[model samples]
Target: MIFPTPEEYTVLVLSLKVGLLCVVISLPFAVLLGWVLARKNFRGKLILDGLCHLPLVLPPVVVGYLLLLLLGRRGFLGQILNDWFGLQIAFTWRGAVLAAAVVGFPLMLRAVRLAIESVDPRLERAARTLGANPLRAFFSITLRLAAPGVLVGSLLAFARSLGEFGATITFVSNIAGETRTLPLAIFTYINQPDGEAAAARLVLLSIILSLGALIASEAIARKMKT
Candidate 1:
């Protein structure tokens, strides 16, 4: 398409916002969990890892329903959040972010864990011998070397969020200017009478955005290797 309609622009901007927020909000946790899973051998570690990756195996609709049960307005934790912080996640843009984050988290965590695992443990220990503490060694050596994987994971999460649909729809209900991301917008257009043109535009936009991210990821990976 040459130019996007205002609605298309809004959907594009909202999708970008959700995708970026998903990565920002989830990255720290992914990094920590990845580090733990890669470096530690604690009790129930396998269970924890499985739980972290559960979203990957479960249906996206099921994941959204679970979130709704936990964070919906009348939900148990949702009630507490609403009463304490005036936060309402269900049927809102914030819920969209949460849904995208949950769905994308497993990919993020797996990439980070594999990346950290690829780093040599002896290098961390060697830093310890040179007066670096664990955190210092990790920040300076281990994490630095793992930057490529982290970049890849972040891009993967962002791409996943951009295309997220079932979970977002179930959790946020596809309100325009709120929860209507690109995928949701496309779904809306597809269902409306004589909306094929709009839907086609969105589908093309989705392909372009996803392809751009993939290309950027590949370029970054290549740069990191050299």
Candidate 2:
């Protein structure tokens, strides 16, 4: 019977929406990069790997700032978007998705890449020898085997996005019902007078949700293996 207030519900819903959107939008690229990193070795591979993982090491605020520089109104691509389509991603929900995606991308890529790498290369080669084309074998065997790892990565990304506060607030300015997600709402409550009780409730909820996601991810991984 422990439920958040109506306003807390809004924040919860918004966080889920943004997190799902982030995962959906980033799935394709994550797969492509995962495949390439796991199977191919080319010149500048290290550079590509570093770029994919840079967000993990950098501060979330720094990631948000870089996004602002690239997507803001006065930014390079931002100017093009503004002039051609009148589109603005900064300080918006879309920007929050972008922030979450940037921050969580490495985790997704790591999971998928490891899964792809763990598969036996000889199986793919054998399938090709058995008359399946490279593409066909890959789609049928490699991707199918890696599905579970990718699923785990996606859930991790979702959990990370749900808690995305620093980058989202930095890029989107914490507008209530717009950019203020669960974590941001929790922070707001903690800063207000006599707000500890509400903040404690939200903290418990956040922990529960995050732990549930991790457990689900592990279960899925096990199912995929069998």
TM-scores, one per candidate: 0.98, 0.95
lDDT of 1: 0.95
**Weakest lDDT window of 10 consecutive positions for candidate 1:** 1-10
Clashing pairs in 2: none
Query: Model 2: how large is the Cα RMSD against the reference?
Result: 1.4
TM-score for candidate 1, residues paired by index: 0.98
Model 2: per-residue Cα lDDT over 1-226, one tens digit each: 4867888888888888898999999889999999999999999999999999998898999999988999999999988998999898999888999999999999899988998998898889989999999899998988888899889989989998988877888888789998888899889999999999888888888898889989999998898789
CA lDDT, candidate 1, residue 183: 94
Relative to the true structure, how large is the alpha-carbon lDDT of every model? Answer: 0.95, 0.90
Off by over 4 Å in 1: none
Tens digits of per-residue lDDT for model 1, 116-208: 999999999999999999999999999999989999999999999999999999999989999999999999989999999999989999999
Give the Å shift of residue 87 in candidate 2: 2.0
Per-residue lDDT, model 2, residue 124, is 94
